[model samples]
Target: MLHQSRQSITCELDAGNSNCLTITACYAANLNTERSDLWVDLINVQQQLSLDSSPWVVGGDFNQISHFSEHSLPSVNCYDSPMSEFRDTLSHLGIFDLRFTRPLHTWSNKCPSSRIAKKLDRILVNQPWVSSFPHSQATFLPPDISDHAPAILNLAVNLPTSGTKPFKFFNYLTKHPLFYQTVLQAWHQSGSIAWDLSHLCVKLKKIKSDIKKLNRENFSDIQERVRVANRLLNDAQVLALTHPTQENFLKEKELHDKWEFLRTIEESYFRQRSRINWLREGDHNTTFFHRLMQVRNSYNSIRSFTLSTGEVVTDPVVMGVIAISHFQQLLAPQTTLTSPCSLAWFQALSPFRCPESNAQAMILLPSDEEIERMLFKLNANKTSGPDSLTSELLKAAWNFLGAEALPWEYRSKDIWIQLKQVSEHTGSLL
Candidate 1:
């Protein structure tokens, strides 16, 4: 079985480099032999090919014919089994047998009386190597002295000569100074820091008022205008080409730059408001929120929280109480009986639910009293003795006081099977 599986050394030509890769098997066999040695030789050849980094082509007596039809002469012991196995082996290795056009017979009978001729000798190449040189041709050269004729192969080689283009950054901006000046002027005219800050706050308040107004006004139009302007400005810097001297290009640059500046201001204002709204909504579970929480926790824990700027802070709670009192003074005039409290004040006092939800769904806010009650209930339920008040409070806060949950629903077997299949196909963990 080992002898039956070995393959012979093969030579391959790289059509791209005219480089030749040659490999040979450990064993050799004659035409009249059992061909078990040829099999072993072929297997070894395959193993060698796998180890080889260079392209390869193999050609030799092969001892076995590739096709039954290649053996035209009548022989009493002719068998198709060897030919079929050879063809299968070639197919399995992804090797292609070269087609011969002239003097097709690769082997001839040594004896004059037998007059047998067979195309047993063949040339093969790795399929990928052949694709680069599709014009390759194989032919049998006339025998000089031996009965076997030498196979001749010819192919063309084409090599790459040049590298790809390099990248340029300055090509993104317009060459004209007037257009450039317009963009700069727009940026400058945007407003001073103090003016912009005040304007940003005012715009944010207006946006909130617009949203709260029960009238059927389409704020989406204003939002879209702001969005479109910002997009134009963001892309203008990328679209402006500095090399060209076309009038149309300058006009386009000027138009886009103006629009971009307008959009940028609007976007900046909207972003500031969005951040304030996000804080007010207590959407602080994200990384930014956690970072702020860490800072606050550190401040609360440390009695002396000093700054790197040589400012010493003594009695942090006293300062915090003072700040809260100042904030309350400012908030009272704006605060309505139904208005939601700021996140800082809301969290600082006992947690109180704001009646800001629609009639369909109610938002739950747990009070400090309710938190204490839940903590007591959780402590009573504990089987172990004497759990700390902090531990009990934490457990209650995480469970009942955090958020609402829906009742459990069972899925059908088919749905579960489909879900599992989808998860497996998409490589999803859930």
Candidate 2:
């Protein structure tokens, strides 16, 4: 039965025995709704699917691309918010995308003028059902009647595996009551801090190397190796927790935690490195910003640092400014003084004298040659010639003194004043 907005038709397959399979064909319209409505719809679908006793398979055109990478059109605008929310919904309901292994462009128009393709259709199945149907595969059929291409998926019933192995808890057994206490005793015996850190680093490195060797040999899966390492780490953590005062145990525990954090960082670096290479080749600054936000959000799990005002500023721009300012401070010159001689000091050493109105004696100013040398030194520091800066400073001095002396009065004073004002106004001041 077909319905609007949210509709799913459930069908039961008659497989001889009491065992049966239920299939749901669902279709959701492309329309924006309030978050609550979306949540309600997702919950309704999930509850309906949960009623099935047999293997459940949901297949239909979801009208959504699971990721931004699925779209390749230059002009097509892709948004991550809705897609991210949808993925979260699927994950919350224990559903895995069955179409992840194939290319994103499933439907393409063969028309000469308008050519468009998109992977709006998808198939989601439970892991147990997927494992049971090993030979089943989903394929996009050729377009014939409509713009969308129908997807065909082959299905199989339950199958048995080779053997049932015992549940392995990795290295959990190594931290048994007897072995853990022995390791703790040995750790307590190691007294030196530096030696303890070095030893812990060596042990962690050896464990990681062993895991890598096993992975390279294709002997075990990553989950197994991680489980084993995690057990060992948990044992170390327990010992540390038991002996809070033991410095060596605490150091070893910290080292183990750091190794895990480093591994996470390495994984994230590789993930972003691939995305950055793709972004460099394409004009997708918007996508780059979106990915940057995701990475920044991931940093929230790390240690938190607060500002002086007790506000936490995690924005990239603020972080970048802090980093740049720190670098500049580190590289700044040792002294703030611009020149060896102050303006007052130079004035005091002058030979020329200015007649004072209040004082009985005349105040001595610098001679033309000595003033020229001082001006040269000042202008040298500012990359402006002595003639220009000295001329401007003198004009300013004359203005401050309220002197309107004519050009010929002080050997072309008018021309000098005009040039000086022009230079100062034009920012040519030393």
**Best model number under lDDT:** 2
Error of 2 at 277 (Å): 26
Per-residue accuracy of model 2 over 96-209 as CA lDDT, tens digit each: 555332345665556758776777677776544443454455656655777666777766311222234312112222312343343334333433222222233233223333
Taken over the whole model, the C-alpha lDDT of each candidate is: 0.45, 0.47
On residues 77-122, what C-alpha lDDT tens digit does candidate 1 reach at each position? 4557767777777766666565444456778887788677787777
Off by over 4 Å in 1: 1-28, 31-34, 51-54, 74-79, 110-112, 157-430
lDDT: worst 10-residue window of model 1: 401-410
Worst 10 residues of 2 by lDDT: 166-175
Task: Tell me, by TM-score, which candidate is best.
Answer: 2
Off by over 4 Å in 2: 1-6, 15-18, 34-39, 48-54, 75-78, 99-103, 109-114, 157-430
* lDDT (Cα) of model 2: 0.47
